[model samples]
Structures are given as structure tokens and as C-alpha cells.
Target: MDRPAQISDSKLPPGNPWRAELRATASLAWPLILTNLTMSLIGATDVLMVGWLGAEELAASSLGFNLAMICAIFCMGLVTASAPMMASEIGRMAHSVRDLRRTFRQAMWAAFTVMIPFWIFLWNTEAVLLFMGQVPELAAKAAVYVRAYMWSILFFLFTLVARNFLSTLEKPIWSLIIGVAGVIGNAIFNYILIFGKLGFPALGLMGAGIGSVLTNMLMFGGMVLVLLFHPKFRRYQLFGRFWRPDWHRYAQLWRLGLPIAVTMGLEGGIFAGAVLLMGLIDTASVAAHAIALQIASLTFMVPMGLAQAATVRVGIGFGKRDPVWIQRAGWTSFVLGTGFMSVMALFIWMFPWQLAGLFMEGNTPQNMEVLQLAVSFLAIAALFQIFDGAQVVGAGMLRGLHDTKIPMIIAAFGYWVIGIGVGAGLAFWLDWRGLGIWIGLASGLGIVAVLMLSRWMMRERIGLLPAQSLSKR
Candidate 1:
């Protein structure tokens, strides 16, 4: 079977394999980068709008959003297993439409499976927060936001499946278009609902939640329509046999996806823990942390996009049993990912105040204090940007080879033991407060980056590669 022009390496310029890989990786990465940016913008817009309600409101909403994100990110990691699975199948046989469809279908099933329990957990957000030692008042307000926002999780998961499908097929432009539209739509809805514009009652924090749910529904609906009708994607019939089960593929998804989910949970959990920690410190600390974290997260989206691109590119190489291609793909993404983040680090370092200003307005004494703390946190984030980029991309590269279990362990130790442990000690034991938490975050990311890159370097000796690729080498 002839591979499609996009999947075949033969068309790469013969005399410059590195340059060819660079071009290929960049072409796939840019749209994904933009898509991730736009997606982050949706959240940032919420945070920005919510900031207007007051510091306590901002803190409460941030807590609610972060808590919801911890669950969503884990579930997303589970479904994302399909990306590498589909990419490798495409590499092995370009026209493996049935295999692709089954993988996608099972991934959606996996998403639905995980969403049920999370929804139950989110519905009782206030109880959980209080149990975790959050202030009763803030917890109650957060619950109000979460109850409305939680409904978006299912829609978001469905959209992720569709986005991963398009991304694996090397057609991520559709995701970018949809994401850009989502940002605009989300902003408009948030304004209308939160501020009570256009004859709608001002719902405040709850309004932000409702706006997100509506935006996610539209995005998911748009993605399904595209998959159903787009000439290229329609042939796969992703929704065909919607009720059928492929037990083997479903099991495989769980096997591969569970570790990925755990890895994401460990990482996202540490950040959520940080928010909880901030909540303990003070309302102002929680608000400042949210601003700084949002800025860091926005920049992190670029490397995340590169990481996603790396997963697909390397998965394709793995399918072809081509170690050299895999190396080229992985290394190309590493260089691009780290290089972009290095520049962003400098920008953050140089302009922390300006970046912090984007999320909050007015220079009242409380705002001024929060602004100062945010600036300090940005400095720490800048220092860790490269490591953050490296670790995420390295994880993506390994994931392409279907090596997730060890990374899960690595994340467990790095994020919780090293990241949170060090952070807690410094914050409380040493009286370093919020700044200490930021330092701990940087430390964990640095450690994880080194470990992930080291593992990638020894992939062959350690048997991370598929048996076929090892034998081929």
C-alpha cells in the first residue's frame, strides 16, 4: 500500500535529512502551537473576567478552575493515547482506516468512562474543598462556579478526541480554526453572562462557568460536524458504529492510557496542590499565584504543542521501524521546543510586571501587593521555562514509542516527592512562604527534565523501543 505523501519520508529533501525533519516538524507544530495558545486563551479570558469581581472572587474561581482542570487533564491524557496509536497505524499502513476508527472510538469510550466519576466528584466540589481545608466561604463560592462549569468536561473530552484524530492525521489546522473561534465565542459569552449585557442576568462567578460550558459545547459540536462532513475525515466515519465495542482495543487504550493519565495527574496535581497551599497562605497569595501561573501556562502552551507534534511524528517513525527517523523527529522537536521556551524565559524575566498586568487591573494597595508577588513568581517561572519545555517534549517523544509506565513513576517522584515536598518544607518549615513554592516547582521540573532526557538517550539500551524497531536497528 502506498503511503500518503504527508506520511512518507521519501519526499524529504534527500541531501538534508535534518533540515527536512525540521521543516516537517515545524509545519506540524505551528498550527498546534496556535491551537494550544487559543485554547489557553479561553481559560485566561475566564480568569481575566473573573478578576473583576474582587480578589476573593478571583481566588475562589481560580480554585474551582484548577480543581476541575486536574481531573480534566488526567482524562485528556487517557484519551490522548489514541494519537500515538493512530499515528503508528498510519505509518505502518497509510490506509488503515478501520484501525484508526476503532482506536478513536475506543478513546471516546475511555473518555466517557472516566468522565462519570469526575462529574460526581466535581458536583460535590464544596465538600471536597472543605475536606481539603479550604475556607468555608471560598469553598462555597467555588462550588457555585464548579457546578456550572463541570458540565463542560464531557464536551471538552469529546472535542479532545476529535482534535487528536485530526492531529494524528497531520491535519491540525482544523483544530486551530476551531480553537480561535472558541476563544472569541468564549470571551463574548463570558462578557454577556458575567456582566449581564444583552438582557441576560449577571451571574458573576457562576456566569463564567456557564460561558465555558457553552463554548465547549459549540467547539465539540463544530468538531463533530467537521469529522462528519469534511471530505478527508468523513471517510473514516469516526461516529459510525457508535455503539459497537472493540474489547481488545479498549483494553489496550486503558493499558497505554492509564499511565499517561497517572503521569498527567501527578503533574497537574502538584500545581493544584500549590493552589491549595496558596489558599492557606492568604487570599492575596492565591490571587497572585493564579495570575503568575496563568502567564506561565500560556507560554508553556508553545512547548506543549511541540510535544504533541513530536508524539505523532515519532509514532510514525516507530510504525515504520525506523530508528533514525524517530531520532530525527524527536531531536527536532526537542530543539524547537526548548529554543522557543528559552526565548520566552527571557521575555518573562525582562517584563514580569507587564505580563502580570494583563490579568489584573487597578493599583489599589491589595492589587499592588498581589502584583508584586506575581512578579516574583514570574521570575521563578522564567528560570524553569526551559526545563518545563524539555520535560514535556521528552515525555511526548517517549510516549510516541509507547513508553509511559516509567514516565509515570518518574512524574510521581519528581512532582510529588521532590516538587511538593521541597515546596512545603521551604514554605512552612523555612518560612519562605509563596516564593518557596515557586522554587520547588522549578526544582521538580529541572529534575524531571534531566531524567526524561536521560531516559530518551538510553531508550535503546533500556528497551524503550518496540521490538521491531530494535531489531531493525
Candidate 2:
């Protein structure tokens, strides 16, 4: 069942694979960058708003949100399977997988199904914190916050699904627009609820949670509205026959997604564990670590966005079984991601103090102690960005190739075995403390970056590419 070329190969510009892939990927990635950045800004806004509430409130909100995000993000990674899967399917000439309705419906089912367990955990947040040995009072406060924030996951997952769906269809601008709208909505909600404006109660930490809920809801609702009314989207009839179940599609998504979930969890868990280590040292170290980690995360969104775009780009090649296209897309993304992170590393190196100052109180003696520590952490974070960007983009490239299971193993071993082992040994045994943990992070990311890159380079050498004949669509 060979299909003719949908777009003529001659349509490609004359250039080396690097220039061609760079142009293609960047075209897809720029809007995605804005979308991802907008999401991060929403989080930064929550942190900023809660900071005004009080120290205890801020601490509880941060800890509680982190706990929630750990579970939520892992599931989000699962949902991410839709990107590469849909990309490959859409690249197909066959009608069987091209409609996208099945993928959309199945993704929604998967999200809701996963949300059930998360709901139970969020509701029992206090018990979980207690079992984890958190302070009783802190656990109680966090519980209240989690209870309110839990409902937001449904909306959050919805927005993600819509974003991935549209993005794979080459409609990233829609997600970007919705995300921008979300930032505005989030700010307005926080101002009204957190400060008790418009005759609303000043709910403080819980208010922040509510603001988040409203932001996610607005994004999801906006996307849905577009899908319904927009002529382009309406053709898909996404909402038509929405109640039907497709167990096979659901299982396929889960099979592809579960390894991604564990892969993301292992990567995120390493950083969370590093934070726990910081806590053991002192309050100041923990505060400094938080500020530094936030900055790292904000910057990481760049490569993360590019990595997502890479998955789509690579997946298209994989679907067509074009090894050349796959290799080109993979390498171009790697270069661009690492190059960008390199520039960022320099920026952080020069302005570490300035960056940390934005988050700190005025430069008092006590504040200076934290400022210094954060500066040090930022320097280390700067070093990690290069490797981190490479590792993440490598992972995304592999995901596009439908190569998940081995990458998951590589990530786990790199993060837990090499990363944690080295950091724990240095911090606890040799007493380098926080700096040691930072070094550990850098080490893990570097090793994984190398391993993932080698896997990609060796794909043909190892006979990993699909052997079936491929033709254009």
C-alpha cells in the first residue's frame, strides 16, 4: 500500500542536513518555546504571590505543590506519548491512523484514568506528608492547600492534551495564545483571591491554589472552545461520539507512555532528593537551593520545548522510515539545544548574584548568607544546563523513534546509580554538602547525555531502525 509523496522532496531547500533540520525544527520550536515559557511563568507567578502571604505560608505552598507536581508531572510525561505517537500517525498515508480522533479520545481517557489515583493521594496529603516525616503543622497546612489544588489536575491535563493534539497538527500558535491568556488570567485571579479583592476572602495559600485551578481551567476551556467553533478544528469532529471507549488504543498509549513516566520520574526525583539533602543541612541552605532550582527549571523549559519539537520532527521521519531525516532532525536539535544552553551558562556565570537577588530580600547580612549560597548553586546549575539540555533533547529524539524502554533504563541508571551515588558519597561521606549535590546533578546529566547521544548515533549501526520498506505519503 505505497502512497505518493504528499509534499514533493524537491520542496526542501538546498542545504546540508544541519541547516535544513535547524530551519524545520526552529520553525516548530519557537511557538512551543513561548507556550512552555508561559506555563513556567504561571508557576513563577504563584511563587511570587504566595511569597507575600508570609514565610510559613510560602514554605507550605512550595512543599505541597512540589509533592503534587511530582505525581502530576510523571503523568504528564505519559500524556506526552501522544505527541510522537500522533506525529507518526499523522505522517502516515493510511487513513487508519491519520484521523487523530482515536488518539485524542484515547489520550483523554488515559488522563482521566490516571487522575483517579492522584486524586486519592492529594486528598490524603496530610497522611502522606506525615508518613514521609514532615512536621505535623506543616503537613496540616500543606494538606489544605493540596485539597484545593487537586481538582486543577483535570483541567491541567486537558490543556496538555489539547496542546499536544494541536501542536502535532502544526497548530502550536493556538497553545501559545491560550498560554498567554492563562498568564493574564492567573495574575488576575491571584490578585483577587490572594489579597481578598472583589469581596472575596483572603485565603492565602489556598487562594494561590484556586488561582492555579482557574488558570488551568481557562486554558483548557479556551482550547475546547476553539476546537468546537474554529472551522479547522470542527472538521475533526473531536467531540462527536466522545463517549465511546477504545481499549486497544488506550493500551497502546499506556504501553508507550509508562516508560516515559518512569523516565521523567527518575530525572525529577533526583533533584527532589537533592533538595531533601539541602534540608538536612539548614534552613538557609534549603531556601538558597529552592531559589537556584527554580531558576534552573525556568531555563530548562527552553530545551524541553525544543526537545518536544524534536520528538515530532523525528517521529515524522520514523513514520516514513526515513533514516536520513531522523538522523538529521535528531542532530540539529541536539546542536541547537546545547548551543543555547551554552549561552545561558555564560549569562548565569556572569550575573549569578543579580539573578539570585531578584528572588531574595534586600541585601541585609542574613540575606547575604543565602545570596552567597544561591550564587554558588547557580554557578553549578549553569554547568549542568549544557548536559541537561543535551540529555533531555536526546531523550526526546529517542522517544520520537519509538525508542523508550532502553532510554528509560539509561536514565535511571545515570540518575540514580551514578548521580545519586556520587552526590551522596561526596555530600554525606566527604562532607561537601550542597555543592556536592549540585556536582552530582551535573555528573548524572552529563553521563546520560553521552549515553543517549551514543544510542542515537549507533541506531543504524545497531540495526534499531525499522527494516520495512518506506515510501512517501
Backbone-clash count (model 2): 1
Q: How does candidate 1 score on lDDT? A: 0.92
Candidate 2, residue 368: Cα displacement in angstroms equals 3.5
TM-score of 1: 0.98
Tens-digit lDDT track of model 2 for 7-125: 32333577665676676688778888889999988888887777666545655666688788877877887888888888888666424333477888888889999989989988998
Write the residue-wise lDDT of candidate 1 on 356-396 in tens digits.
Answer: 99888647999989999999999999999999999999999
Off by over 4 Å in 2: 1-11, 14-17, 94-99, 363-366, 469-473
**Prediction 2 TM-score vs. true:** 0.93
Question: Root-mean-square deviation of each candidate, in angstroms?
Answer: 1.3, 2.9
**Clashes by residue pair, model 1:** none
**CA error at residue 252 for candidate 1, angstroms:** 0.3
